[model samples]
Target: MTEQLSTTFNSLREAWLQHRPDERQRREDLLRLRSAFKASLPQMTEAISRDFGHRSAHESMLAEAMIVLKEIDHCLHKLKKWMKPQRRKAGWQFWPAKAEIRFVPLGVVGILSPWNYPVNLSLTPLISAIAAGNHVFLKPSEHTPHTNAYLTRLLHDCFPQNRVSIIQGGADIAAAFSSLPFDHLFFTGSTAVGKKVMAAAAKNLTPVTLELGGKSPALIAPDADLTKTVSRILTGKLFNAGQTCIAPDYVLLPENQLETFIAECQSQTAQRYNEANGQTDYTAIINESQYKRLTGLADDASIRGHKVIPLLSLNDTQKAENRHILPPMLVINPDDDSAIMQEEIFGPLLPVKTYRSYDEALRYIITRDRPLAFYIFSSSNEPVENALSNVVAGSVCINDTLYQFACANLPFGGVGMSGMGHYHGEEGFKTFSKVMPVLRKYNPAATDYLRPPYGRFADTLIRFLTK
Candidate 1:
């Protein structure tokens, strides 16, 4: 496996070096990928659904298919302009010389994507690398074997193996893949694993962009509308069963309104999901291991005397394990030191914490490790502005959640322990590109006057320039 990985990488790298893709070829590649992706939507949806036990087709279309299609369209529309050399002003002393930066492909890019949102995560970065005109090698999550199979076929049909290749395997293969000497490495997964990926990439001095997960918090101000806040929070939190990296891991709101928020959450969950009828609209936990982890989080909180409020009926709780579908639940005021509060809870369990003052809430978020995303729900502009100005996060969405990631124009990434680097939109293009600066001289040399030793003209020019 190691030999095969190295040989494949060498072949792609050699091909890229021998004949780098031109603007036209890059555009054609993106167009081909877009067409192939659209043609396989139905099969892709089924594969993803099968991987997750019962992933919703609607959610799959809305989140995965729609998002990737929009990204492809975005790249196609902006590729030409992004490829053009950007003009930069030259210094007055070097007036005859012209300066510009050219956006060129970085030989080869390797993408290591996670199981959650497999299609979107894998393809979005792939689209960006293609837009920047780089050959790519991708490693999808092992947990989503069915989806990975579909992706392999779709990508292979779109391009030759040298242009784009999808490799599938478990941890051993992943380790070997990460250790390869690629021009750039992109990883989307947990912070713990992100560290390992970075360490591996460091041995080769390979630059990496890690899109890691952390405990993202949603801050609800006193003036915020409880109904709207609860609805938006649940929508983002429950989407993909709260398996999203930027999903609201917890909520911090006014102390007096905790019960009201809980009640509103119950109402919203009942309205949105129809678990009683066994409808497949609600997504299940990805696997038995994930299911057990989520259940264990809630159980630990419950044993510690935290009020675990189930939005669904008692009957649904009995059959939840069999289906691996843990309904949405609120863990009221779990201790700050508890497991749920300490780790990134990638599940349907939302820990609601109360804050006496708005500053207190801000302090709570500010003191923790910088998160991938920070959400502020406020009716008035003061608290929103305050939070925006004071809090530090990779991205921020006012009065809502998850839509920050949906914006094709914004850069999505993390900070501190969350992760590093950005992607999506022009940032994504830049992430996979080598923005090389070039200086072209058109006429007589500007520095010729200063080249002589102990010359009076040189002294005058130096003084004038310094002054």
Candidate 2:
């Protein structure tokens, strides 16, 4: 597998060296990329659902298929503007010289995408790279074989093997792919794997954008509407069974409103899905392994005396283990040292922590490694504004969740250990682009007096400029 990936990488690099795509060719390629996905929407949806072991078709379409389509449309409309060089003002010291900032295409870009939201993660970066006029080599997660096959075929139909391609394989291939020293490496996964990817890329001084997972917290501010707030939190947490990186990992509740929020959460979660089983719009864990891992998290929390409550009454349904469907759960006041509190709970287990004051909540969040996302639900903008001022995050959704990614105008990334760099909106274009500053000296004698030669005039000019 590693050998095959190496050979494919060589081929892609050679292709990039041979065919440097201009703006027009890139536009044509992007149009083809969007068209191919449009033609295969149904197939793409089905492929992802199958790989997820009963993933909701609506969720697949909304999160993966629909998001990719929107991203492509965004790139297509803005590519021309994004490609144009912007005139920058030359300082008075360099007066009579013209300056501009040009966005140059990096060579071959290598992307390592994740299984969750497979289509969106795989193609969003690809669109940005292509729009920036670079070739791409993508490797989708091995867990999503069905989706990978679809991507391999769909992308091939739109592009030649070298211009844009997919390499389908397991971890060995992934490790090999990361070490190849591509011009840029874009990765979306857990922080552990992100560290490994960055380390490998460091060998070649390859720049990387890691969209890694962290325990994102949603704060329920004072005067928040309990019903509306709970509904929004459930929408973010239960979507994709909480496999999203930006999904609210836990909820920080105002102590006075804890009971009201709990009641509302129970009601909202019940109304969101027909059954906790695999029969409704609710999704299953990707496989038996993930199912076990999530259950273990809950069980460990329970044994440690934390209150782990199932949001639904699953008494009448088949065992969740049998269907690999882990129901949504709420953990009340977990121990600070608990695994559920310390780790990125990527499942539906949302631990609720109470705060007596907003200062306490803000301080708690600040004490940890910066998260990929933060949610503030407040009736008034003042509290939200205050929290926003005090907190730092990769992205923030005010009075809601997961809507931050919907805007193609904003940059999405993490700070500190959550991850580094960004890849969405205009930031995505810049991530794959090399911003080169070009200065042309049309007037030759602009700095003649400042040049070497110790003269009274030179000294006077230097003193004047220095002053």
Q: What 10-residue stretch in candidate 1 is worst by lDDT? A: 313-322
Question: Candidate 2: misplaced stretches above 4 Å?
Answer: 275-279, 315-322, 446-453
lDDT of 1 by residue, 1-467 (tens): 89989889998998899989998998899889888899999999999989998888999999999999999999899988999999999877787898999998998999999999999999999999998989999999999999999999999899889888888899899899999999999999999999999999999999999999899999999999999999999988999989999999999999999889988998878877765656556788899999998899999998899999998653454365346878889999999988899899999999999999999999999999999999999999999999998899999989899998989999999999999999998999999999999998877774766585758887887798899
Per-model lDDT: 0.91, 0.87
* Candidate that would win on TM-score: 1
In candidate 2, how many clashes are counted?
A: 0
Instruction: Tell how far residue 184 is off in model 2, in angstroms.
Output: 0.5
TM value for model 2: 0.96
Tell how far residue 201 is off in model 2, in angstroms.
Answer: 0.2
lDDT of candidate 1 at residue 335, scale 0 to 100: 98
Per-model TM against the reference: 0.97, 0.96
